[model samples]
Target: MAYKDQKLSEEKVFKDPVHRYVHVRDRVIWDLIAAPEFQRLRRIKQLGTTNLTFHGAEHSRFNHSLGVYEIVRRIISNFENRPHWNNEERLLCLCAALLHDLGHGPFSHSFEKVFKLDHEYFTQQIIIGDTKINNILEKVSPGFSQKVADVIAKTYKDKLVVSLISSQIDADRMDYLQRDAYYTGVSYGHFDMERILRVMRPMEDQVVIKSTGMHAVEDYIMSRYQMYWQVYFHPVTRSAEVILSKILHRAKELYESDDFIFKLKPTHFISFFEGKVKLEEYLKLDESIVHYYFQLWQEEQDDILRDLCERFMNRRLFKYVEFNPNLQMKQWMELYQLFQDAGIHPEYYLVVDSSSDLPYDFYRPGEEEERLPIHLVMPDNSLKELSRHSDIVEAISGKKRTDHKLYFPKDRLDAVEDEQLKHRIIEILYGQGEVKDVR
Candidate 1:
């Protein structure tokens, strides 16, 4: 065994809820897990605001990272006696799996949207920068850190290794879907991962499933689809995300305005507001730090900031209505004016949130960021695209379904001093003024 391949005398194991036990045998993998950059993931939740919707979904990114690494470890272990599988890239796959989400900040989606930050860029920085992760990879060899970063970026020379960690049916998604489902107590993410793994074989340029495993592959696809709509794209989770984004937006606005005085200035967020956030400043944030700022902002003199923070911290999220902007443009405009006339800042109070995704896709040549299509290796040793073999997958292939909801503070509308103004808003929300699912 090489320095990178040195195995521990006794493998270490973590008791995980999703994967049962995540085993670590490689010295390098253990070292990377112990590094501070990897440790930071413990503070970042795997599914940002989904916890507010699913009380049991309190697992952190650290949990999911370990599961992913374990999956890749199992995958490579299975590939050990198989041909066309490079023994050298085994550690690279494990390292990339463990550290892929290293750059995620607190409440990733909203934080990235409001701050205009890219977790992927930060991921590259932490791996390639002069940090603990870089130092560890440097111990492996010169250019090793860059290699792992490239693997994560899906630009590595060996497409087979890249596909193992990033492709549609890779370890990352495999771990998260199962882990999230277990935590959220949802039945949707269950799939025969064992059967899928058994069918997976490394090819020269990619990993492909055997034709016999088509049913398992279809099950995995369905699990992904169910988990997306049931857990990831839950409207209530989006409500919390909306509130979180609004809170950040208000904080950023106040940070930039002269009228606001901060008893506790956002030392960590200043760089973000200035549009020049460095890696160190970005890494200094987590859910707790954000909550700390939120707690204090409730006391700030700025009513909008204070109110939004209190709502977020207290779980008083805005209510939402099914809204299609294209079909209901006039209604949306009318509601906007009503909010403004009612003294509610339409910009802050009225928001449209949309969630959309293409559940599965075949190889799309010449398109931007084209995902490597999932391929099934037939018994004859020829490969066919996933949608071609799986009817369930084909039905939703290349089809992007989107759901949009208009979010507003219902309590604010209800407390309006003007009777008729409130009546009109309520009437529009419930055509016959029948209040349903107001919460």
Candidate 2:
């Protein structure tokens, strides 16, 4: 048999906590899993800084990636005998699903914010560039690697294949919602996934749900909404994220300072600080490698860098209070100066973090990031958008909910020896004459 047509004599099954078992029969998938590029995911956490909040959320991207592939595999199995489901696209969909998150760096979102790097771009490079994964994909056909990349990029001509992985209710979201919930030990992510899968119908360009499964889809949507607020956007998780992003920023700032000399050179971060990271260099800096640097930087001469590292390594996280952007603009400015007066560097010390989620949204013309809403197949075989059919979905559809918080090290504010300065700052922060900062 040709390389692409090769299969193992017996199926290989990985015991998964979420899926129970992830079965592999295709040689291509087994090889891809073993590839060094894909294996790097084991070191990258699925939910960055979240593990610090929920100890059980120590799962890695490798775990979630495998779960995504398994979900897609089951989905495709259902699609096989159905009309409009092309068997030829099966391998492409499977590969795309598995490799979709291949390029996520350690503490992915925080790293991206600090370094201006896009994981999706790196994922495309991994698929098409000089790498073991690219070689495996190229073995399938001359341009097969690019085809996989395009599918991931959502530019593939086969919109049906694209929807299977990238759509709002597709395998990627389905897997992560359950997997993240499982790892975090939260009840919000639970939903009737089996029913959703059973009701899935492949269309010419997309997947539609049978009207019978509308309730199940609604449950999934609400589960996602609850998970975002309760687990994904937990204030504690955001606190750690704020500190992590600051550590990256402080390190980058010191790297660019001409007068500053590192007692120990930041070898792992030099490329990232310079904004010209090579693919190999990017691959080399996983979570363990980042933690190693964080440990060493704890002893650095730079007080800000050393202090931030200590806070992250020891879990001395910043405390946050709800922030109203419209009303608190002036208050925030005054507090910024008060922080500076108290010898706390406002730049690194005070940060406003905002998180927003749109549980479901229909297509909006000319919007930069358009969400293709879920559709339901009616009894008469007509298709209707999910929000139109379900009152529950309609209640929150297209209406984005946003939360903002101002995060700062309350311990540092407490250590401010200037009693009046502390009291005044506390007064603004807590609206009390007492100096203690209230939660």
Candidate 3:
């Protein structure tokens, strides 16, 4: 009840590119951001190895977290006088948005793949465990931390609040879709977020976009579609991920093998390899620490370890070409043998990367794991599923688009003077003509 009247004497502001200025007027919100656990977001890149491709995408999760929080703040501010909007849930929404990504570690997706770590688990830990975030949340009310976690976990009883953060067109998607686009300098992610936010309405158990704003909703869905293919699932990004995964795997293998002696001994990677990493150890890891290991490993005695590290650090990304798995199986095998004959390890050099996404899905009744589909509030007060009314959404709804690429080091192939072997490999990769830039 005290929070109803509580506000910071001097509002805190974070200069943000996406949101312009993220303002915090609540004492609890300001304290939550200052918490060491939340501040750790500064070390984690928002797009991981994406900075390798889009150099401007060097922004951190801290930037995104603040942007998400600002978006939620604006949404709550907009919903203040709307029907079915509870003033009590305002702080909870803001807290959930600010702390949602607190659990993300350095290169979250790649680290999680290698170590099997769950950032969501750590997200709940930071809020509910004995940490600064927990202490701050508890100050608001007993069990407030759990309440905040519930909202993030999407199990909060108030579906409206859940929808605000996790729905098809919520603040989380709204912020990232635009923020990532801005940082990546891509035109596809441009959507009228202001128009979308203005048209948002809180309904029973869900949020809906007014039918008049259907075009805006269509734009948002299309933006998501483009961002997914053009940015999130870019083959080059996946290629980088493949190389990173191999680097981690190689380090783990070396640590297990008696032949390998690391210069730094890979102390940070030990617990991860042994599958007993502590939260504190995990927190110590950032891109810098990982890069430190990679830099040292460049001078490692093991060729595989040194090569992978050098390739990753120097941006010598694996080259890729379109290939079907079933049809190209024989060619892939021959390429592998060719690489072996050429003294290059086929395992590391040859890779196939694929990425896919379902842009939108209409709610299917009786489906156990159905997502609450986006609904357009019609002029006559009836509601329609997004795809039913919007042509673009209809074109992409439940449509899974996929892209596959065969990756290899083209620079290595170009230097090979073995005309017979080089031609065979090049023919397999590029078919007839030279491989052009996929972009």
Candidate 4:
């Protein structure tokens, strides 16, 4: 099978901080990026609320898409003329990487949680549906678009192609870990990509790391763990997310209430509230539209909506204190009531945020969905699951880490002139005599 007879007259290059330069040689990849659907990534932030915590993380999905594509290009270049890597899958891998996050919208996580929108479904729609992406892909072959989507969906029959971009430790992870660290100015994501790429071997159905590169693999795993805790799971980011969720919830409630009146009704959010959003409308909603509503809602009559929007916009984030959920249920409820008495809407102002994630999981038969586990190719051509040989991987695998915190507005409570009510709320938050000493 031959690829589409497409090539750029001059290779386009995007100067990226993580991958250095993203090269575009194929017309299909170029056209897909230029398509309005793909360009929408420019308006959608890569880390969503994380930008509130890490000021440098204002990068977009457009940045990550290019990074993923560059990583795949390097991987393919490394595997060229090597055994078990089909040259035919080259274009397939590149297309899959470029379009992987094409379905993401503004504030992807919060929007997905509130509106029940699946970025993956929209990704498939943009790729195989009636769109510029599909048109360009079909220029290569009638079935090429589906082939690319299958690779992204991890349903492609060729495991080699699917593994290149979708496996546990693939181009997507490799790019994001480094790219996110670079943008967020975090030291946790520094890993030896060149060494990893040099040691990468194409197996019968997947890519494997040579045994000598075990330390490099260990570094990558540790980097992922650190990046998760230090950047992705930061409490400040979660605080912003909490505020964003409440803002959306308040807006939806107002829209449903007969008493509520809007200076300008949000038509973009109407279908989302009704749960019938179309693709065109979804594409129109980037971070700009969401920010526009937030700015407008700053003057909303509903105090909860206005307050939450102002807090989110001004970076007056919720203050969090460490707490044990299992043991502190009574104290949590008492604090909620105290907040209500203090004239703060407990539903919108007081929150409990809990985040739990497994950094890495080894292959557990019948346990998990069986993540395509990373394997180390031994001298005798035998493969070993990483945890079985590396103590670091074993120590971290299957271990779920959790963080719990109680979030509330400290600035508001500080301004309270009611000494009795202020003392009560502070006592509940910090235990009896703790508040008096701190003040």
Report the number of the highest-TM-score candidate: 2
- Once fitted onto the true fold, the runs of candidate 2 whose alpha carbons sit more than 4 angstroms away are 356-369, 398-400, 432-439
- In every candidate, how many clashes are there? 0, 0, 0, 0
User: What would you estimate as the lDDT of candidate 3?
Assistant: 0.83
Candidate 1 C-alpha lDDT tens digits along 1-439: 6668688999899998877899988899888889988888899888887878898998899998899998998999999979899887888888999988888888888877888888899999999998999998988889999999999999999999999988878998899889999999998999999999999999999999989999998899888878877887787888888888888888888888887878887898889888898888888888888889889999998889899888888888888888767677877778889999999998888888877421222322223435567889998899988888788888866666677787888889988999999888887776423332424
- lDDT for residue 6 in candidate 2, whole number 0-100: 93
Query: Order the candidates by lDDT, highest first — what do you get?
Result: 2, 1, 4, 3
Return the lDDT, model 2, position 47: 89
Clashing pairs in 3: none
Alpha carbon deviation, residue 49, candidate 3 (Å): 1.4
Please give each candidate's TM-score: 0.94, 0.95, 0.92, 0.93
Model 4: per-residue lDDT, tens digit, 1-439?
A: 2446578899999988887789998877888889888888988888888888788999999999988999999999999999999998888899899999999988877777877788899899888888888888998988999999999998999898888887778898898889899989988988999999999999988899999999998999888888888888887888888899889888988998989988888988998888888877877888989999999999988888988999999988888777677777877788888888888989888877777421223323122534668889999999988878889877877677676777778888998888999988887778522221101
Model 2 TM-score (2 dp): 0.95
Judging by lDDT, tell me the better candidate of 3 and 4.
4
Off by over 4 Å in 1: 357-370, 398-400, 431-439
Sort order, TM-score high to low? 2, 1, 4, 3
Candidate 3 local lDDT, 340-429, one digit each (tens): 887778777787766632122332211234656888898897888887887787787767576567777787788777889988888888
Question: All models: lDDT?
Answer: 0.85, 0.88, 0.83, 0.84
How well is each residue in 187-230 modelled by candidate 2, as lDDT tens digits? Answer: 78899998999999999999989999999999998888788778
The alpha-carbon RMSD values of the candidates against the true structure, listed in the order shown, are 2.5, 2.7, 2.9, 3.1
